[model samples]
Target: MRNKVTKAIFPVAGLGTRFLPATKSVPKEIMTLVDRPLVQYAIDEARAAGIKEFIFVTSRGKSALEDYFDEAPQLEQTLRKAGKTELLEILKSTNMDSGEIAYMRQHKALGLGHAVWCARRLVGNEPFAVMLPDDVIAAEKPCLQQMVEAYAETGGNMVAAMEVPSDKTNAYGILDIGEDMGAMVSVKGMVEKPKTGEAPSNLAVIGRYILHPNVLRNLNRIKAGAGGEIQLTDAIAAEIGTEKGVYGYRFRGQRFDCGSKAGFLQATVAFGLARDDLRDDLETYLHELLAARKAAE
Candidate 1:
């Protein structure tokens, strides 16, 4: 039997250089999508997937990210006094129980593999999940939950895969396919940011992952690959053809790369339109803006 994936590692150490002035004061993960922070979306997804322990690999200037999960006693008391039951319930969802979440500091800005490696001791020998807060997915069934269910049936290293344009393959860890099995594919190899026209397949690896502990072990002896940073894809790629091979899962959702400015704005608009309270007014404003742009053109 495969060990259940009860723990999840969230890599939140990256300095959000892209967002600049806003990120200077606020960690990117604390930036709100609709009303909830990016990290909150990740935490909610993990909770839906039945993850027990939440491990965050962080760096300095991430105290706000850590504090976001802490309970606010005074705020809760005030809510109770005002009889704001609905608002109190929403606030309570942000509080993480003691011992349920752990934080490990990544002192250097090495790479994603290094950040994940920071939490190796905490993950122990069990299978664990890795979630990137920047890649938020909007799905009826959360993307991580989808992968966790699939992991139960096929117990090797599983990565969330999506088909990107062949021209854009250089931007992702492209997969070399062994067999194309409907929703899942048997992965023969993984290439991180392959040069143009050298990509094996357009099916690219995304942020969500359910990995075996051996991948972490691979990181222990890993040399820097690709962009001179410790790439997590290199570590996971090492597990391609062991007894339990690596597999790619095509998750059901629209993924937004929230790390980029364009993607962030797109996600905000998309998520805003999805809300009952904001949809009509937001939709009308969007149509009016488009019409005005067209008139100017």
Candidate 2:
């Protein structure tokens, strides 16, 4: 039997240079979309996928991110005293059990591959999942859970993939199609940020990944590719044509790239509209704003 994927690594060490002054003090992972922080969505999704070990690859200034998952005893007490049971329940969700989570400092701004490699000791020789907090997926079934189910059937290395427009292909890791298996595609090869119009296929690799232990071994020898960073795509691509080949899972979800300013705002609006309490009023405000822009136009 294949080892069940119970461990997940979250690479959250990036200096949120794009978000500037706000990120100067606060780790980007703690930035809120709706009421929950970005990392909370990732964590919740991992929990839904039955992940037990949460490994965070962090940097020096990410104490706030660490604190976000730590128990807020005083706040919980305050909520308890006020009889805010609903609010207290929400707080409980944020608290990670003592041994359930571990943090490893990357120290250097290397790359996704390097960040993941930092957790190799913790992961041991088992299959593990890597979730990028920036790529938030809104799905009826969490994206990782969907991938995990698929990974069970086809166990190798699986990445969450979605089709991108040809013009936008240059911005993503484009996959070369081997076999189109509807919801899942057998990956022929992976090219990290191929030149526009030169992409093998429009299927772009996203954040969620269920990787075999060998991929971590592959990362051990990978050199920096594309933008002078150790691209994770390279290590994964090396597994193509191996005994357990790589697969691209077309997960059922709407994904938002919260790493960018535009994507962050779009996710904010999308997530705000998703909340029943805020939906109607937020929709009305959005319509009003659009109408005002059109009138100006």
Top candidate, metric lDDT:
1
RMSD of each: 0.8, 0.9
User: How many clashes does each candidate structure show, in the order listed?
Assistant: 0, 0
lDDT of each: 0.95, 0.94
TM-score per model over all chains: 0.99, 0.98
Give every collision pair in model 2. none
- On residues 33-53, what C-alpha lDDT tens digit does candidate 2 reach at each position? 889999999999999999999
Write down the lDDT that model 2 would get: 0.94
Estimate, for each residue in 1-297, the C-alpha lDDT of model 1 and write its tens digit.
778999999999999999999999899999999999999999999999999999999989999998899998899999999999999999999999999999999998889999999999999999999999999999999999999999999998999999999899999999999999999999999999999999999999999999999999999999988878999999998998898789999999999999999999999999999999999999999999999999999
| lDDT score at residue 68, model 2, on the 0-100 scale | 87
